[model samples]
Target: MSESFELADADRLTVGTVGPPGHRVFYLQAGEAGRTITLKVEKQQVAVLSQAIAELLADLRAPEAIAAAGELLEPVDPLWAVGGMQIAYDQDDDRLILVAQELLAEEDADEDDAAVGRLRFTREQAAALVARGEELVEAGRPPCPWCGYPLDPAGHSCPRTNGHRPPTP
Candidate 1:
C-alpha cells in the first residue's frame, strides 16, 4: 500500500510549475518541519483550486498580508499524481483543509489502496497559493482567440478557421 500523509498546521503550502509554457508540469507541495510532500497536478487543477480557495475566503473576513515568496524546495520529486482534491474550512480551528487523493489507474482493482494527503494551512497560505496559482497559469502560452485553446508557440491550427489558414503565431 502507498504511504499517506497528514500535515497539520503546515508551515508551507504552495503550487508551482516547471518546464516551458506548452510543456509545463504543475505541482502542489506541502511541508512542515523537514518532511515535504509533492504531488503532480494538472494546470486545470491549480486554476480550480485557486478559484475555490478564493471563494471560500470571500465568505470570511479579510486575511492578513501574504507571506514572503519562497522557491520550491529541492528534490521536487512527487510521491504521486493527484486524481481528485477537496477543500474545506474548519471554523473551530480557523484553518483551511486541503485533501488530495492519489490517481489510480482504472484497471487497478483496489481503489482503497490509493494514497491520500491531508494538509491544513492558514488563511494567509491559502491566499498566497491562490495568487501563485493564478500567476503560474497565466504565464503559460496565450489561448486561441477563436477556439479558446492554448496556442502553440511554433504554430496552431485553429479549428474555427478549419485548415485553410495557417497556424496562429
Candidate 2:
C-alpha cells in the first residue's frame, strides 16, 4: 500500500552498489532538480537492464541524439526496494522508460495493492546509465580471464586449467 511516483525529466540516473564485492548491495536511482527516488536492485537485474538500455539506444539510429550522461551514482532517501522492473522505449517521444514496482506480499496478488514507479529519460541518459552500469559491475571481483568465473581473493580454480591452479612461478 504505497504511493507511486515518476521522474519524467530527471537530471541524473545511476546504478551502483555499496560494501565489498561479496557483500555488496546494488541500487538504481534517479533524480531531478528537487525530486529523487531510489530502489534496491539485484546485480542480475542491473546487468540485464544495462544491456537492454544499451541495445535500445543503439536502435535510435542517431548517435548525436544522445546527450552527455552524468556519471554520478548516489541515491538520496531510497523509497523502497523494487520487486519487479520493466523497460521500453517510447518511439514517438524518443525516450527510454523504466518502471520499478514495489514488492508486495506474495500471497497478495491483488492489483490494487501494487505501487509502481516510473522513469523517462532521453536516449543520452540511457546511454549514460549503461556506461555507469558497466563501470559499477566491473568494479567488483576481477573474473578469471580463462574460464570467465570470478577469482576469489584466495585464488580461484580455473576449470579451463584442467583442475590445476595457475602454475606457481
Candidate 3:
C-alpha cells in the first residue's frame, strides 16, 4: 500500500499520503453539516485508475499522454475519476497522494472538454469506429480503413506491392 491516501472537496481535489504503512482506501464522507446527496467512491475504481496511471507512465512521460489517460477515465464514476486528482511523490516518506471528486451533472462540460482535447474524438465517434473495426475482423475480410494493410503473424508479403510475389506460407 502507498503511504498516503488522496482527499478532495467540492471546490478542489488533492492527493497526499500521511506517510508509510498507510493503506489506500476510498470513502464518501459527509459534507459540512447536512447534505441530501452524499459523495461516493469505491476502492475498485481507485485500483482501476491506478492501473491507468501505470499504463500512462509505461512508454512516455508526456503531459499530453498523462492527460489522455485521464481522459479515458472521464466516463468512469466521477468519484473515482482521476482527472482532477493530484499526485504527490515523496521518496523519503514513501507516500503517494491522489485526490478526486464526484462531479455533478452540471459539470459535464468540463469532462467533455478534457476528453475531447486528448482523444480528438467524441465518445460516440470512438464507439462507432470501434464497432466498425470489430465487424471487419469478425468477417475475416480486409482490414478497415483505420487499420490499413494488415500484416501476417510472421513477416508481410503482399503482391499488391510493386513487382511483388504472392504471399507464401
Among these predicted structures, which one has the highest TM-score? 1
lDDT of 3 at 88: 35
For this target, which candidate reaches the highest lDDT against the unseen true structure?
A: 1
Candidate 3 lDDT over 1-169, as tens digits, reads 1122222221112121211212322322212122211223333444454454444334333223111111111212222222343333333533233344333355464543332101122222222322332332233323323334544444455646542644443
TM-score of 2: 0.77
Q: Please give the range of 10 consecutive residues that has the lowest summed lDDT in model 2.
A: 68-77
**TM per prediction:** 0.95, 0.77, 0.22
Which residues of candidate 3, in runs, are more than 4 Å off? 1-39, 42-48, 53-84, 107-169
Q: Which residue pairs show backbone clashes in model 2?
A: 67-124
The 10-residue segment of model 3 with minimum total lDDT is 65-74
Better of 1 and 3 by lDDT: 1
Kindly list the per-residue Cα lDDT of model 2 for residues 1-169, writing each as its tens digit: 8779988877778877777886778888888787767787878788888888877777776555545444435444567778888899888987778998887777976766888999988777788788888777878777778877777777667778887668231
* Ten-residue stretch with the least lDDT total in model 1: 65-74
**Per-residue lDDT of 129 in model 1:** 92
